[model samples]
Structures are given as C-alpha cells and as structure tokens.
Target chain A: MMKGADPDAPRLWREGDRLHVDVRGLCCPEPLVAVLRLIDGGEAGDGLVAHVSQEPLLLYPELNARGWRYRLVAPRGDDEVALEMSRPRA
Target chain B: MTLFLASARSRLLPASVPFRFFAIAAALHVALWVALIFAAGEFTQFRGGVGHALGAAHLLTVGVLTMTAVGAAMQLLPVATTRPLAAVWPTKTVFCLLAPGALALIFGMFAAHVGAMIAGATACAAGLLLFAGLLADNLRRASSMPLVRAYGWAAFVALVLLLALGFALALDNSLGFLADHAGLALVHMILGAFGFMGLLALGLSHVLVPMFALSSAPKGRVAWAGFALAAATVAAAIIGALLGLPSVLAGACGLGFAAALLHLWLMRATLKSGMRKRLGLSFVLVRVAWAALALTPLFGLAALAGWGPGGTLFGLVALGGWLMTFLFAILQRIAPFLASMHVSRTGGGPALLSDFSAAAPLKVHACCHFAALAGLALAIVLDNAPLAALAACVGLAGALAFGLFLAGIVKTLASGKI
Candidate 1:
C-alpha cells in the first residue's frame, strides 16, 4: 500500500484511501513526475507504491533523502522490487 | 529527479540498443544501393525499370529511414528523461527482429512472398511497440520545454497511426483485404514520410540545431507552430485522401511543411546570432543543413507545379536532399563530439574540432555527392534515363569516397589527437 503526503494530491488510483502507482517497468523521473503531477493536481493520500527495478543502486538513497517512508516489497521469482511509500501526516 | 545528462563514454556508444539496429539499417541502405546500381543499364527483368529508384529507394526510405529514426529516438528519449532503459533484452530483441525483418520484407515484396511480408510487418510492429513503451516513460516525465514534450507525444501517436497504415498495406498485399490496393503506396508515404519521419526530424532538430551549434534554442510560439502546422497538415492530407476532397489540399499541406522549414530556417538564424564567435567546420556543415532545408520546399514547389514525373524527383529531394544531408551534417558533429567527450571525461584536455573532421577525400566526395544528387534531380526534370545513369554513376563514386573518408575519421580518432 502507498501513502500520500499532502492529502491534496490528485488521486490517480486508490487502494482504499491510498494513491498507488504501479511503477513496475517505469523508469526514473517518470514514476516520480507522475506522482508529483498527481500531488500538484490536488490529489494526495496513503499507500503510493512505486514498484521499480532495484538494478540501479543509485536510485534508492535519493528516494529516502526526500523523506518518503518506504518499505521494499520483494516477490518470489521476479527481478523487480516494489517500494511502498507514504507521506507523513502534516 | 535530477536532469538527464549524457556521460562521456555513453556518448560514443549508441544508446545501448538502437545503435546496433541503426548500423544494421545503414548497412542495408548501402547494400540496397549497390543492388540498385547493378540493376541499372542491363536488367530489364525487374518489375520496375532498371534504376536506383526502384528497390534501393524503398529500402533506404523505409528500412534505413524508419530504423535510424526509431533507434535515435529510443536512445535519445532515455537521455532526456534521465531514465535508464526498461529492459536491455527487449531492446536488443527489437533490433534483431527489425533488421532481418526489413530485409525479408523488401525481398518478400519482389518475390511475392505474402507470408514473409506479413511476418516482417508483425516483427517490426512488435519492435516499435517496445520502443513506444520506452518513449511513453519519457513523455510521462515533466519537462519545462513544452514544444519538445508536445512533439514527442505527437510523434508517438503518428508512429501508431503509421504502423496501423503499414499493417493495412501488408494485409492488402498478403491477405487481399483490397485486391486493387488503392493508392496504398501514397498513403504509406504520406503517413510514414510526412507524418512520422518529418515530425520526428522537426522535433529533434529543435534540440540538435541548438545543442551542436551552442546556440539558444527556438522558444515560444514559433517552435509550437512548426509542430502544430506539421501535425495538422499531415492529418489534413490524410483526410483529403480519404474524402477525395482534392489533390490541392495535399499541395497545401506540403506548402505548409515548407513553411515550417522556413520557420526553422529563421529560428536557425536566431541560433546563429547568439552562437560562440569561433565556430568551425561544424558550423559550415550546419549551414549546409540549412541549404538542404531550402531544398525541401523546392521539392514541395516541384510537386505543386505538376511537373512530369516530378514527384519522383521531389521525393529524392526530400528524402536524400533534406533528410540525408541533415543526417550527415549532424553525424559530423556527433561523431567528434562523442570522441572528444569520451577522451575529456577520462581526463584528456581540449582538442581542435578540425582534428576530427574528414578532410581531403571525404570533402571532395561530399561535393561530388551533392552534385550527383543535383544532376539526378535535373535528369528527372528532363526525363532522361541516360543522364540519370550518369548522375547515379557519379553518385556511386561519391559514396565510395565517403566510405574511404569515414575510414580516415576512425583512424584519426584512434590516433588520439589529445
């Protein structure tokens, strides 16, 4: 489940109250930009899962530094890792 | 996310996938050219007359043109997005499929191999779908440059339409969807040439013309207008075709494309005014690109004027004259830029642009090549096969010279000028 930051971020999708974007096969800036666009559009919530490949080691630290609360979700037999991210309550 | 900027070595290497495909495509172009030359003078056996226009032209236009454009976009969009490729295997797979597929498709045309043609189209469409997936990622990213964004989006849509049209043509030829095949060739040209390739070129030129020249890009409405006019004109042309409205609309659209070029030329003038004072042969090459831009409109003029068999000449003007000449001009910049960037990133100091330029023979060849093309255009105007042949022979000489010059460039790069 993914989480929203501002609660005003546009809801592209909802797992109940959370905005989730399945960023599987989605590369950088794409995933981030889409999320930001939603946020900027007055949509926000919890459980924003940005599922992406963890091949680039450089990507994760940047996400963490941005204050995104993320949990890495790993599935069996798949090369991809899903980062379940949520915004803290303001 | 941080903006995507190319690393040193990455510049030299073709963006992981398309470079290999483009290489294969260029090889196909050269081989098809060879065949066209051989087919001339003594081969009446071909369904069409013996000439470069018959086989090589199709292969060059479709195989080389589309392949290179697709590959460049695949590589470049990632760079723009600051995104790495989705999957290496799929990218490689696409190239592997498209290369042999294009050849088989072309051969399939002459051999009446309906199955092969259908198979080739399927393979290519699959490859393009993969490419589109990658590009979609880029388009999703936020960019301040709306013109680039708009053009990128339209190019993808145009690509989808072009592929659909290609499928229709393939099915008609293979499955006999329409036995007569009404103006299918013209439709293919309109969609592929004007819609897909033209828009891609125009969009990318907005980047390349400025970047290589170290000039300020064309901003504001002029850039957007160019994109809008091209997209609208292409759509109108296609609509006119379907409606049986008038051939004149097609002429109008072509004139509109010429107008787009005129806009670009003016924008290029703007780029020039602000460029670094000590620009070199790359600048000269860019000027040549401008000259080619002029030819694109001249082609539209020739088409509009209803000159006899002039469409063929006009096609060459747009295809080889504007597109190929612009491609080569950019290549001259790209090749050296790549080498220099690689060397510098690894700690080599500044180097002269002339150090990498293809001097002597390549220069001579370029002159001959342009002259040969001009002569061929003139011959078509005169409707003289003998003169066309003479021009083609000269063209062949120029091609050989270019090949030798390319070898020299490689040699110079390997020598380490820094």
Candidate 2:
C-alpha cells in the first residue's frame, strides 16, 4: 500500500488481483506521483488501476521504461478517466 | 520524504545541451544591447543597409531569438510530444553552427564584407535546415498533442519560407540581380518575426503558461480556432507583402489582432481560474508583453497609414516590446525550473525554486526593461539620437541584471546550498 503524506491524499484500495487508486479532484503530477508511489512500494503487481480526472501522460514514459503497459479504462460511475496498467506475467 | 522528489526523466536530455544554448543566448543578450548602444546615433534614420543598425537587428534576430528558440524547442518539444528526440548530435551541431554563424553574420553586416556574409549565411542556413528537419520528424511522431502539433507544423512551414527568402536577401546584397530587393526584404522580416518565431512562441505559450500557472489548459475548440486564425494571418501577411497589396496586408493585421485577442483571453481566463493565487512578478512581465502584442497590429496599421515614425514604432513594439519581453519572462522561470529538474536527476534532493531565484534582480530588470521600451518609443517620436542612446544603456543594464539572476541560479546549483 502507498503511504499518504496528507489527509487529502488519494484513497487507495485493493480488489481481487488489482490495486485501485482514486485520484479524483487531484491535479496533474499528483495522480502521476500516486501511481509512481504504488509502483515504488512494490504493490504494483500485474494489476494497477488509477482513476484520475486528467490524462496521466507523464506516467506513460515511466511505465513503459519499467516494462509496464497501460490502457485507458472507460469511466464507471463518477470516474472521469481510469488507466489500467500491468507488467505481463513471465 | 524531502519536499521534492526526482520526477520521471525519460524524455529529458542531458542538461548540457540546452544549457549551452541558453548560456550563449544570455551572452548574446548583452552583446545585443552593446550593439544597440553603439548604433543609437543611426537608429532612428536606419532604413536597413550594412551598418551598426542592421548588424544589431541581426544580432537580436539570429543571435537571441532563433538561438533561444532552438534551445527551448529541443527540450520542450519532447515534453509536449511525450517522446524523446531520436538523436542528439544534430541538436548540438545546430548550436555549434548557429552560434559562430550569427557572430560572423553580424560582423559581416557591420563591415559590409560580401565574402563573410556568404559564408555566414551558408552556415546559418545549414544549421537552421538541420533543426527544421529534426523538428519535422519529432512533430510527425506527435499524434497526441493536436493543437501543439498544428502550431508546430505551421511554424515549420513559415521557417522554410523565411530561410528561402533570407538566402535570397543575403545574395542580393552582393549580386544586385533582384529588382525588388526591398520587397523581398520586407517579406523576409514578416516571415521571420511574425511567421516563424512568432508562431513558435505562441505555440509554446499554450503549454508553458498553464503548466506554470497551475491552471487548466485552454479548451480545444477555442485554441484550435486561434491557431487557425494565426496561421491564416501569417499566410495573408506574406502573400500581401509579396504582391504589394496594402489592403490585404491590413486584413492580415486584422486577423493577427483577432488571434492575439483570443490568445490573451484564454490566457487571462486560465490565470484567473488558476490554483495559484499569486503567480509572482513574472506574470507582471507576461501581462506587459500581452499588452504590447495587442498593440503591434495597431502599430502595423499606423505604419500602413503613413503616420509619423510608424515603421519604427511597429518594429520596436513587435520585436522589443512583445517578443523580447515575453521571452525573458518565460526564460526567467524556465531556467530555474530546468535547473531544478536536472538537480533532481542527480542524487541529492532537488533545489527549491524559490532558493535558486533571486527576486531583486528580476525587479530591477522589469523596471529597466519597461523604461527602455518607453524611452526608445519617445526617442523615435522626438527623433532624438542621444535619448535613444541613453535608452539602450538602460536596456543593457536590464540585460546585465538578468545575467546576474542567471548567475545566481548557477551559483545555487554549484554550491548545492539551500
């Protein structure tokens, strides 16, 4: 799990075989930073989904460099944008 | 955790490349003022020939604007496109060729040496053509940022036209083959200033302004229309000038005004709604530049009307008031920002932007810059050489102050001090 430095940091949760980060209402670099934190925390297995209002373009290069792949996940409910990323199982 | 974490660094270039270009630009900034100071006597009456006025004009055009454009574009283009430049050597080579080439061209213009001018022009064209090639390749790959890409493409086209006309103008100096030397020269200036560098600056503003201000980026539809209008304006202006159509040229100015208005509205609205309540003194300079941009078309109209000193007013406002002012404002912010980004790449914690920035020098610069602009405008109105010379000194002081600000950033980076 990613640690939060602020009380208002994005909420994080886990659902079967996936970690979901809700970065709604947060600005750019914040969502990207949250995703990075998840990756650095070793919690990013094969299924990490980030919900953000803005497209996390900055994260794409980092994700690719780390052997991770991502695709946009159409919003369900109030999520403006959801990006799903994973490293393929060996 | 420290306040700053090293951000993702995939597309970022080795810091040295952009820094070298910037350093050269800063040095040339001082050189430009020095040239202006020397040419002040001839400044008002200078209708363009091989002299200090002409040399100084080239120094600012090639030396400062184009030099900074290349450097900033190389670094920022990748960021906008989310892809790294395919190769680096071409970029470094551009700097190598352009830096000396600008100096030689300026010197040649000063001395009226045809051989030196030819060699310098050849070198500059080679450097610019290579840069255009690199820009085209990168822009081609950028499918995501549509508005930015569109602006880039338009700017690229304008650059090609400018280069073609620029070469013709240079050759005409010696060969005397062309009948309409003045006509072609007018086209060359219009394309270089409003077409190439102008578009590039406008495009980059779309990216940089929102990012720095922490504002939402402008809506796509409005920005797209603005870009279209700007491109149309450039086309109309070039065609009008080439065909000797004054009314069509005025129409182009009208289009330019519409585009400028739209751009300013978007920027102003963004700034107003920004998360940042106080965007610092840099925005003050930016606002001033916007005002100057708004006046440029009006000044162009005045020039067309055969008003007193209209040509001089138009040139000063367009080049010095709008472009130069806006560039310095953005560069003030970008230099430290890039420095911080680079410092974070190293092992240590990233330097705070506030620590690296020295406010006093920026304040000094702002005051002096505005004074120089006003004084020069007044000098033209009065046809006073000494006043123009004095204004150049003020402008030079402002440039030096900016240099000190840059030096402060370097010192902060070197010492690794808070």
Candidate 3:
C-alpha cells in the first residue's frame, strides 16, 4: 500500500537543530493544524518545514513563530512539498 | 464532481480571496524586524543614512505589513465570498520575487550601493505588480462584505500606485529626482500605511478580533465611520501632496484616523465589557493592541497640535507600539491553532487544540513583548539606541521563543496519534 514515505529521502529531512515537515498538497486547517502539533511537542525555535502544495502556502507563519525555522519549498510536482526548518542556535 | 469543481473554481481565480497574503507577509514582517535591529545597529542616532532608513521602512511595509495583509485577505475572501483564487502562480510569483528583492534592497542600503538597491526594488516592483494583477482580478469578484470589499478595491488601486511610486523613488535616489522626493514620500507613506495596511487592519480586525476573543461583531454605523474616515484621510493626504498644501490635509488625515480608532475603541470596549471573564494570550493581545491604537491617534493629534518631537514618536507609536505588539499576540494563538489544524488527524486522535503547550510560555512572552515594546517606544522618543536595542532584543527573545513554540506543538501532535 504505502511506501512509508521514503525514509532515506525524508519528505521531512532533519539535521541537528533543524526539522522540516512537508504538509504540502494540503489545505488550511491542515497546514496550520499539523504545524501546531509539532510546536506543541516543542519543535519550534529553529527552522522547520510546514511544506505543502500551494493550497496552504499562505499560512506558513505559524511554523516560524513556534521556533521551527520556516522555509516553504514547493517541489515542481503538484504532489510534493518540502518544509525546511532550522533552529536559530540549533 | 460538479459541485467540487465549482467550489475549486470559485477559490482559484485571482488567488484565494479571504486575503491569505497576511501569512506570507507576516514572515516578511518579522524577518525585516530582525534585519532592521541588526542593520540599524551600525548607524548612530544621527548617522544620517537616508538609504538605510528608507530600506528598513520598506522591509517593514512591503516585507512585513503588506505580505500579511495580502495573505489574510486571500484566506478570508472565501469566507466573505464563498469563492477561491483564480490562479496559484500569482501568490508564488509575488513571494518568489519579493523575498530576494527585499533582501537585496536592504543589503544595498546597508552597503551604500545604489545599484543593488535599484535591482532589488525592481524585483520587488515585479512582485508587487503580480500582487496587484491578482488583487484586481479578485476584487472584481470578491465578496460583498462592505469593509472587506472596499479594501479589495483600495488594495488593487493602492498596489499599482505604490509600485509606481517605489520605482520612481528608487530611480530618483540614483539619478536625482530630488524635488519630487517630498511629495512622493507623503504619497508613499499614505498609500503604504493608510491605504493598504490601515484599511486591511481596520477591516480584518472586525472579523479577527471578534473570532479570537469571542466578542460580538461590530455594529454597522460605527464601522462605517471608520471606513469613511480612513478613506477621507487617504484621499486628502494624496491631494495635499500634489498641491503642497499647509500640511493641513495631513493634519485632517490624522483626525480621520482618530475617528476610525475611536470607533474601534467603542467596539473594543463593548467586547471587553461583555466578556464573562478574561481569557488567553490571544485576548491579552486583543486588549494590548487597543492601548497601542489609542497611542496612535494621541500622537497623531499631538502632531496636529504641534507638539515637539511628535513626528518621531508617532512612527514609534504606530509601527512599534500599535502594529507590532498587536501582531505578536495574534501570532501566538494563531500559530498553535493553525499548526493543530494542519496536523493529519486520525479519527481516534486526541483533540490537538485542547492539548496545546502550556499557557505559561505565552504569559512569559506577553510580558517580554510588552516590556520590549515599551522600551522601544521610549528609546525612539528619547533617541536612545542601546535602550531601543535592549528592548528589541527582549521582544526578539519572546518572538524567537514564539518561533520555538511551533516545535512544542509538533511534539504534542506526533507524540501520539494526536
């Protein structure tokens, strides 16, 4: 069924002090909602991806505020989004 | 299938409407704020770097304020119109061009390099053009909500006018269109603040504050006064600039803004009075912003009344005192709310909204935010750099911690099926 989202090719890639979450191809409540969960778990303050397709692109700031360094990466394909997040001091 | 297609079409054209630009713009806002703190540090109180000040102002206006308004409008348009944006490219285009351009301009200003500034401003203008085109297309079909609708109309017109003025200013700095500078400066400030940000803030706050604070909607007559006053001020200011009048128009514009703020104050007090009990950080933000708004026109009136150093402090009051403080509070709540909303929930998942990171951090942030803002206002009025920076750094701490809050929320979400 599901390919488990490419472990080696993390749709969400994380290096020390950075976390990226790809919520692309999704819509409003979804993008914001997902990011909130991460912040609730204390993943904010550096860079983090709340990546999604164009649908949720405008609502990315919720990611930045919680401390996940926020970067919006829209892959050319309609299906993929890369949210690149980093912490300020790691 | 047909129903789905119709809904999609309604939202896509001219970009999704309830105004989502605020989202993108918000990031830009903070980025600029951070940049300014670092960049402005090099210059002493009277270092006299005209370009530096101008560039920083642009970052605040274009990068921070406009971006947020744009995003917010797009997001809210659907709620207002039951429709979506036409094309997606416009939003992407605006951001893609703007982010880098703003960087370049700010860099140019710091380095005293006109060429970089010109190049950067051009990119920003291109981004703004796309924004205008998309806004115009949306305005033709945007909702019938009077306040929101009028803003759409004004935003389109203002976007075009602002871009043209920005370009001229950029060139003038290089080739010297010195005489036009003062007039254009007035026009630019009027359009940037009063036209775009002011209108958007006035209109959106009607929906936003109520939603966040659980207050009742604004009464019609009061809102109309605000709308009319904001419109009159912009119009008068624009005309005044053209004719070189006795700054009376600007003074009158100040009065108009006061009228608008007063109406909002009435609406706010109504909300506060009706509250069964005080609530979260978001509501705290709602309350604090009013204080900032109160200062805005007080300073405006002081300017009108010819109080000394009123001009200097007014900027502090409006930009730092009002907009920044208000925005931070909203962000704290929205950040968590939006994050939780975006989580891919399982049917059996814990309700994420209820499980947010503790209110303690928010309370801490609030204290820091207010202190920083107070310090900044004092620093500006007193012209104290160290004081301003110290205050800003604290605000930055709260802001940075606010940024950190995202992670806490994520952990809560992923920790379990919740």
Candidate topping TM-score: 2
lDDT for each residue of candidate 1 in B251-284, tens digit (9 for 90 to 100): 6557665666765665567566543345554455
Q: Per-residue lDDT of B1-418 in model 2, one digit per residue for the tens?
A: 1222223334677767887787778888889888888888888766667788889888888988888889889988887676568888999999888888888888889888877787788788889998999899999977556777888989999898888888777888899888888878888888888988899999888777877665555656898998999899889988998899999989998999999999999898878865555878888988999999889999989989988788888888888888888888888887776676545324444344654578999999999999988998999888888899899899899889988998777665565554
For DockQ, candidate 1 versus 2, the one ahead is: 2
The positional error of residue B31 in candidate 1, measured at the CA in angstroms, is 2.2
lDDT of candidate 3 over B167-286, digit per residue (tens): 787778789966868677767776777676666666666655544444444546767776677677777767876677747665655766576576567566646743224556666776
lDDT of 3 at B166: 74
Q: What is the TM-score of candidate 1?
A: 0.70
lDDT of each: 0.58, 0.79, 0.59
- lDDT preference between candidates 2 and 3, better one: 2
User: Clashes in candidate 1: how many?
Assistant: 17
Candidate 2: pairs in clash: none
Runs in model 2 with CA error above 4 Å?
A1-90, B1-9, B344-348, B411-418
Residue B327 C-alpha lDDT in model 1 = 60
Score candidate 1 by DockQ: 0.03
Model 1 alpha-carbon drift over 4 Å, by segment: A1-90, B1-18, B39-54, B110-112, B247-251, B254-258, B277-305, B341-355, B404-418
